[model samples]
Target: MRQYLPVKKFEWPWSRRDNGQNEFSPLIPKSGAAKVEDEELGHVDNEYQTGTPSNQDHNSPTRIQPHYSYSLMDYFLKYFLFLCNLVFTVLGLVVLGLGIWGLSSKESFAQEKIGTIGTDPMLILLTLGFLLTLLCLTGCVGALRENCCLLKMFSVIVLVLITIQVLFAIVAYTVQDQIEGYLRSGMLAAMVGYQDDLDLRFITDEIQLGLQCCGADTYRDWEVNLYYNCSAPGVLACGVPATCCVDPLENGTVWNSQCGVGAQLMDEFTAQSVIFLGGCLGGISRWIKQHEGLIGTVGVVVVGVQILAVFITTRLLENIHRHKAHA
Candidate 1:
C-alpha cells in the first residue's frame, strides 16, 4: 500500500519535506484499495469541489483540433492542381526545348534571326518557358504535399512571368519591321555596297573623262554605259567611244538599261510570318488557360461533372445488362 503525503497545492517542480534525506518526489495520487474506495466515495464531493470533467467536457480538446481528413472536394482539387501543373510543365518544356534548339542551330534558322524564333529571341523565350515550367512543377509538388504556401508562391510567379512574356511579345510584334531591319543591319555590317555598279550619267566632258578612266573596271564600264548617250556635245557615245557622238540619240540611251531594282520581298514576308506566329502563341496561351481551374476551383467542377456523367452512363449500362439477363 503506497502512501501519499497530503498535498497542499499542486505546484510544478514540487517541493518535499524530507527526514534527513531531503529527496523530493512528485505528489502522485496513491492507487491502493483504500484510495480507490475513497475515490469512488468522494467522487461527488470532488465533482462539487474541483468539478471533475465529463467525457464530453474532456472531448473539447479533440473537437477543437483541426480536421486532417481528405474529402471528395480535396481529391478533386488535387486532381485539378495536378492536371494544370502537368500541362504547364509539359508545354513549358516544349517551348524551352525548341527555343534553345532554334537559337543554337542553323538547321532551324529563322529568317528574322536576331530574335524572331531562332536567334537571341529564342533564348529569351526558352528562359521564360523554363521558369514558367519550374513554377508549375513546384506548384504541382506543393499540391501533392498539401503545401499552401508553396502553391501560392508558385501561382504568383507563374502569373507574373506570363504577363511579362505577353506584354513583350505584343510590343515586339507591333514593331516587327523596325526590329527586322535592326537585326539585318547587325548581321551584315561587315561588307560595303558595290558602288561602281550604280548608274552614272556621262553627258559632259569631265564625266566622259572620268568614265574613260574608271570604265576599265567591269563594274565602272557597266555604270558608264548604263547612262551614256550619243546626243551630248562634250561626251563620248556609249558604244563607239569618245569621237562617235555627233547628234541626237534615243531617250532610252539617257537612262540606265536595267529596268528595275531587284529588291527581294522575302524580308517583308518573313516579318509578316513572325507577327502571325506571335498571334498563334497567344492563341495557345488562351487554350491552356481554358483548361486551368479558377483559383484552382476548376477541379471541383470537373469532378462533379465527371461524376454525374459516370453515374448516368453506369445506370444506362446496368439497365442494358438487366435487359440482357432477362432476355
Candidate 2:
C-alpha cells in the first residue's frame, strides 16, 4: 500500500535502452532525470517492477503491468520464515512423539479402548501436536517452494488460532471469579484419586512441594480421600500426605514418609509445627499475582510472532502473484 517516490525509469537488460524513452513515453510525465537503479530499488523496498514492453505491441503492453522482481529484504524475510517454521516443526514432531508415547504406554488405543480413545486425555496432546506440526510444516514447505496455496493456508490457520487465543483470553479474564472455584474442585477431585492415578498423584505432590501447601483449601481437605478420612480404619486415616510435611526428610536425608500422620486430628497450632496448614489455592493465586507481568509478556510475544509470520507470508504471496501476472 506504500506509494513509491516517482523517479526516472530504469531499463532492464533487454529494455529498448532508447535513452529511457519508448512508446509509453507520452503516457509517463517527462521527468527528464537520469536513471538511478539503486535509488529505484531502495525506494520500492519490496517488489521491483520493470516494464516489459514488447516490440510488436507497444500500445497493448501499456495496459499491462511490468515484470516483478523480489528485493533483498523480501528474500531475507522468506528465508527467515522458513527457518522459524523449521524450528517449530521439529518441536511439534517431538511433542507429537511424546503424545503417541503417552497414549501407547497407557494402551489407550487397545482394541477395547480404541472406541473411546477420542475422549482420552492423551488425545488432547496428540491433537495439539498434530495441528502444530501440520501448520508449521505447511509454512516451511510453502516458504521453500514459494507455493501460494500452502502459504495462504498457513496464514489463515494462524489468524484463526490467534483469534481463538484472544477470545479465550478475554473470556477467561471476564470469568476470573469462577476460575478459582473450578481450580478448587479440580484439586479436590485430584486428591480423591491421589492413590489411584499416578498422574494426579505426581501433580498433587509437585504442587504440595513447590508451594509448601497441603490440600485444596486446607490440610483437612485430604479427608476427601477414602484412606485419609477420619472414620477410615487404616493407618493413613486422619493423616495428610507426606508432601504436606514441613520437613518430610529425617536426618536431612531419608524421607520421613509418616511425618504427616494424624495431622488432621491436631489443632491448628499443633499442626502448624508439623505440616503446611495453608492450601495450594492460596499459593497458586499468589504465584500468579507475582508473575502476571511475565505471563502477559509471554502472551504478547506469542501473538506478535504469529502476526509477523502472517505479514511475511502476505508479502511473499503478493510478490509471487505479481511475478506470475507479468510472466
Candidate 3:
C-alpha cells in the first residue's frame, strides 16, 4: 500500500531459515522460555554426568557396596590359636614317644604281658597323646587353611572332651569318700601283684618315693605280696621295700637294700622312726587339698582357651559364608 514495495524480514543472528515458510527460529532464544529450557537441559546433563538426579526420591533404596574387613584382633587370635595348638601337638608327640619307650623297655608287647596291656599306665599315656595329637593337628591345619569341616570336627571333639572332664570333676568332688575307697582298692590290688608286674613295681616305687609313703595303709601292707609274706621262704619275707625306709642309703651313698629287712616285725613306735607311717592315699588327699586353687586356675584357663578357639572358629566360618555369598 503505502510503499508498494516488498518488506525485508528481520532475523536474529541465532535464527534458522525455514525454506518453504520463510520463518526464522532462534536456536538459543533470549526470552524467559529460553532461560527455563536452558536450565532444564543443564539439569539433565548434570544428572547424566553424576548418574542420578539431585531431586531423587528419598524413599527409594540406595545402592551401596558392602564392606568386608578383618580387624587386628581377628588376625592375632587366629594365629595365636594356631600356635597354641601347634605347641600342644608337639607336646602330644613327646608324650606318645615316652609312652612307646616305656612299653618297649618293659617288653609289654610280649604275649604273656599282652593281657595286662589294657590297664597299663603307658597305654593310657599313648591313648591320650594320640587323641591330643590328632585333635590339635586338625585344628592347626583347619586354622591355617580355613577349612570348615576340620574346624567343626575339632570343635565337636573338644566339646565332648570338655563335657567328659566336667562330669569326671563333678563325680570326683561329689563322691570323694567313694573315690578314696576305690583308690585304696586299686592300691591294694597293685601291691598284690607288685612283685609279679614290673610296671606295677615301678609305679609303686615311684608313688612311695614321691609321697614319702610306705604302702596302702602302712609299711606292713607289703606282706600281702606272696614273696613278702612272713611265711614266704625268700629273704623279702616280712621285709618292706627299701623305698619305705627313712634312710635307704648307707654311709650317705651306698644303696641300703637291706635297710627295710625285718621292718614289719617292729612295733608301731619303733617303725614310725624308720619309715613313713602315713599311707599314699592320705598323702594324695593332702596334696590335692593343698593345690586345689592351682588346679582350679589351670582348669579354668584350659576351658577358657577351648572356648576362645570355638569362638574364633565360628567367626571364621561366618566370614567364609559371607564372602561366598558376596562372591
Q: Report the number of the highest-TM-score candidate.
A: 3
Task: Report the lDDT tens digits of candidate 1 across residue range 30-95.
Answer: 556856777676886777787655454656654353434445654666667667677888999998
Task: Give model 1 RMSD, 1 decimal.
Answer: 24.6
What's model 2's lDDT at 223? 93
Question: If both were scored by TM-score, which would come out higher, candidate 1 or candidate 2?
Answer: 2
List TM-score per model, in order: 0.34, 0.75, 0.79
Per-residue lDDT for 188-264 in model 2, tens only? 98899888656578889999999999999899999999999999999999999899999999999999989988999
lDDT per residue (tens digit) for residues 1-327 in model 3: 859978988988789565653212554345667677877888999989989867676667678867666668767767876888899999999989988998899899999989988878789889888988999999999888878899889888888888888899898899999999999999998999888777789999899999999889778788888888999998988988888888898889999988888888889899988878788898888889999999999998988888877887788777766766765
Number of clashing residue pairs, candidate 2: 0
TM-score of 1: 0.34
Q: Show pairs that collide, candidate 2.
A: none
Off by over 4 Å in 1: 1-68, 107-119, 159-327
Model 2 stretches with alpha carbons more than 4 Å out: 1-67, 110-121
Best by lDDT: 2
Evaluate residue 170 in candidate 2 and report its C-alpha lDDT on the 0 to 100 scale: 99
- Evaluated against the true structure, the overall lDDT of model 2 is 0.88
Q: Is candidate 2 or candidate 3 better by TM-score?
A: 3
